[model samples]
Target: MPRIKSPALLVAESGADREGHGLRRSMGLFQLICFGVGAIVGTGIFVGLSDSVAQAGPAVVVSFVLAAITCVFTAFAFAELGGAIPVSGSSYSFAYAGLGETTAFLVGWCLLLEYGVSVSAVAVGWSQYVNELLDSLLGVQLPAALSASPGDGGAVNLPAVLVIAMAAALLVRGVRESARATAAMAVLKLAILVAFCAIGLSAFRDGNLMPFAPAGIAGIGAGTTAAFFSYIGFDAITTAGEEARNPRRDIPVAILVCIGVVTVLYCAVALAAIGAIGGDAVGGQPAALSYVVDEVTGSGVGGGIVAFGAVVAIASVVLAVMYGQSRILMSMSRDGLIPGVFEKVSPRTATPVAGTLIIAVVFAVPAAFSSLDAVVNLCTIGTLAVMAAVNVAVIALRRREPELPRTFRVPLYPVLPLLGVGCCLYLMYETGWTTWLQFAAFLAAGLLVYLGYGRRRSRLARVTPDADATDAVPQPV
Candidate 1:
C-alpha cells in the first residue's frame, strides 16, 4: 500500500538548502506572468479559433466567456493550493499532501500526457505556420515529405522536429535565461495580436454577427469546449514554484493576471476574426486570423505578419509546456515515486538535465510523425481530469488542515470548487465516450506502474526519525 506525504515535506523539498541540488529561485513576478502568458496564448487560439467559430458561428464570443468563467473557478482553487504548498508538482503535489500517494502518482501521469501531447500539438501547428510564412515571403515551401506528419502525406515533419529541439536546448541552458527568451517571445506575440485586433475591428460589419448562436445552446456548449483549450496552459505557472523568487505570492498573482490578460486578448482576436471574414470563412480556414487579415486588406502582407506571430506564439508555448513537464517529473522523483535520476539537478544551471532530455525526445517523435488531432484529444482528456482532481484536493485540504497558512485564498468557500469540478466533468463528458475509454486505458497503465513500482519505492513509506507523524501511516509496504 502507498502512504501519504505531509504537506510540510513537500514545501521543504522545494525551499530547503540542498547543497546545490535545488532549483534556482531566480524568477520574479514579471517573468512568471510572461511564462503563464507564453503558455496560455498558443495554437489553441492561433489555430483553434476557427474550430470554435465553426461550432458556434459568431456566438464563439459567448463560448470564450463561458470557458473563462470555468477557468477562473479552477484558477482560484490552484491559487490557494499553490500559496499553501509552494511546490513544483503543481496539482500532483497538492494531491499528495491532501489525498494519498496513489492519487498523486495518477495526477502526475495524467500531467505527463497533458504536457507532452500539448507540446507535440503546438509543434505541429508551428510547422504549418512556418510553411505558410515561407511560401508568402519567398515563393518557396518545404516539400510535403518534410513538412507534414506520416498520415498527412509527409514522412517526417522537419520543422516540428527542429522547433522542439531548439526549445529543449534553450531549457538546458538555465531557467532564468529560458524565462528571458519566453518573455521576449510573449511580448512579440502580444504586440502582433494587438495589431491584428486594431486592423480587424476597423472592418467589423454588424451583419456577420446576425446568425450568432446558430446552433442553439448545444452549439454554445460545443464552442465553449473548443475555446477551453486556450486556458489550459495557465496551470504551468504553478509548476514553476521551486524556481519562483516568492512562490506563495507570485504564483497566484501570475495565474490570475495571465488568465485575465489572455481572456481579453482572445475575445478581441476572435471578434476581429469573425468581423473581418464572417463565420463561414473562419470556420473553414485553419489559419483564421491570417486569412481574415488578407481578406480585409486584399494583400498577403497582413497575412504574412499574422503567420510570423503564430510561429512565435507556438514556439513559446512549446518552451513553457516542456519546462513545466520536467519540473513535475523532478517533483515525483524526489518523492521516490519514479527513478531518482529525474530528481537530479545540475549544479551549474540548477535544472534537471536528464528529465528535460527525456521529455524532449518523447514529444519530438510524435510531433514529427503523429496526427495533431490525436495529440489534442489526449491532452484535453488528461488535463480535464487532473484539474477536476485539483479542485477536490483544495476542498479536502481546507477541511483537513485549516491551520495551514495560505497567502491566497479562494473566495466563496466550497461553491467555487464544487462548480469547478462540475464544469470540468461536463467538459470531459463532452469529449465523447471514446476519449473516456482512452483515458481509462491510460489510468489503468498508471495504476499498474504505481502498484508494481511506486508503492514499494515511495519515500513516505519509511518512518524516518525526522518524518512527521502524519506521514507515517502504517500500510502493506
Candidate 2:
C-alpha cells in the first residue's frame, strides 16, 4: 500500500496569496481570548444555568467542573492542531488537512449546525433578557407582538432579529472591529457577574444545599451534559489561527486561559445564585439568578442588574458565534466544497460579505420566530459530534505526524483525547432523542448536498491524475 499524504503537511508556502480573499493577519492573543470568552460565557451562564440547576440541584456546580474537564481535554487537542494548521474554519480546516475531502465535508456540515444554530439560539435568549431589562428598569415593556415567538404567545422576536442583524453588520465591517466589540461586551458582562457574585455571596444561606444531588447521578449526568453546551465557544479561539499574530504560541494560551477564566466565573455565579435563593427555588424557574436576587434583597435591583448583564452577554454570544459561522462558510467555499461566492471578500473591509449576508438572513429568520430551546439543543448535538471528531483527529495526527511541530500537546496523548470523546458522546446521549433525530436528519441532508454538488466541485476530488498517482493511498479512515 502506498503511503497516504496528509494535507496537514501541505503548508501554503509563506507569502503565497489566495485570490479574492484579502483577510489580513491582524488578531492577537488578547483578541482571540476575548472572542472565546465572549462567545462561551453568554447563553450558558445567563439562561442555561437555571435549566442545569433544575436537573441537578446545587450539584450543578459539580456539573460545571465536569463540563470544564471535558472542555479542557478537547481544548488541548484543538490547541495542538490549531497551532500546527493555523487556519480559519477550525475543525473543518483541520479535518480537511488531516483526514480527506469526505470527512472534511461532514465536519464542515456539523460546524454549520454548531455555529449557526448556536448564534440563533443566543439571539433568542438575548431578546428575553432585553425584555426583562426593559420591564424592570424603564417601566416599559415590548408589546407581546414583538417580544416572543408566535408559538410562545407573541407574534415575533423583534429584539432577537435586531441583535442578529446588528451582529451581521458588525461582522461585515471587519474582523478586527468585531473582535473589539466582542471584547468590550465580554468585559462588561464579566464585571456584572463578579458584582452579582460579591453581593449574593454576602447573603449566602447554608441550608440551600441540603439535597445537593437531589436527582441522583442520572440527573447530575444530564446536567453535566447540558452544562457542556456553555463551553462550546472556547474553540472559537482556534478558528482565528490564520489571523493570530503568533498562532503557534498564542492560540493554545488563548484557549486554555479563556477556559480557566470561564470555569471560575461559572462556579462563582452558580454558588452565589444557589446560596442566595435556596437551591429549590433557583432550580425551579427561568432567570434563576434574577429571581433569587429579588427574593434576597426584597427589591428588584439585583434582578435588574442580572437582566442587564444577560442582555450584553447574549448579544456578545450572537456576534461571536455568527462570526464563526461566516468564517467556516468562507473556508469551505475557498476549498471548493461550496459555491465560490461565499469566499468573495469585500475589498474595502476584507470580510466575506456574501457569506455574512446569507448567515445573517438564516439566523435572523429563525430567531424571529423559533424557540431558543430547539436551536440550543441542535447546537449542543452538533458541537458534541464535532468535538468527538477533533478528539479522534488529534490522536490520528499524533501517530501519523510524529514529527509535526506542536506548540501545545494533550499531556497524556491518547488518554486525554479518548476521554474527550467519551465525555462528548455521553453528553450527546443526554441531549434527548428529539435532538438526536434532528442531528441525524441534518447529517443526512449534508450527505445529499455532498453527493449532489460537493463531490464534483471539491478541490480534493479534482486532484491531478499525476498527483493522484504519486500519492495513491487509501485516505485515512
Query: Which candidate comes out best when scored by TM-score?
Result: 1
Give me the runs in candidate 1 sitting further than 4 Å from their true place: 16-21, 464-477
Model 2 bad stretches (over 4 Å): 1-21, 464-477
Residues 400-453, candidate 2: write the lDDT tens digits.
677677778889878999999998898888888998888899999998998799
Listed per model in order, the count of residue pairs whose N, CA or C atoms clash below 3 Å is: 0, 0
Q: Please estimate how well model 1 matches the true structure, expressed as its whole-model Cα lDDT.
A: 0.87
Native-referenced Cα lDDT, model 2: 0.81
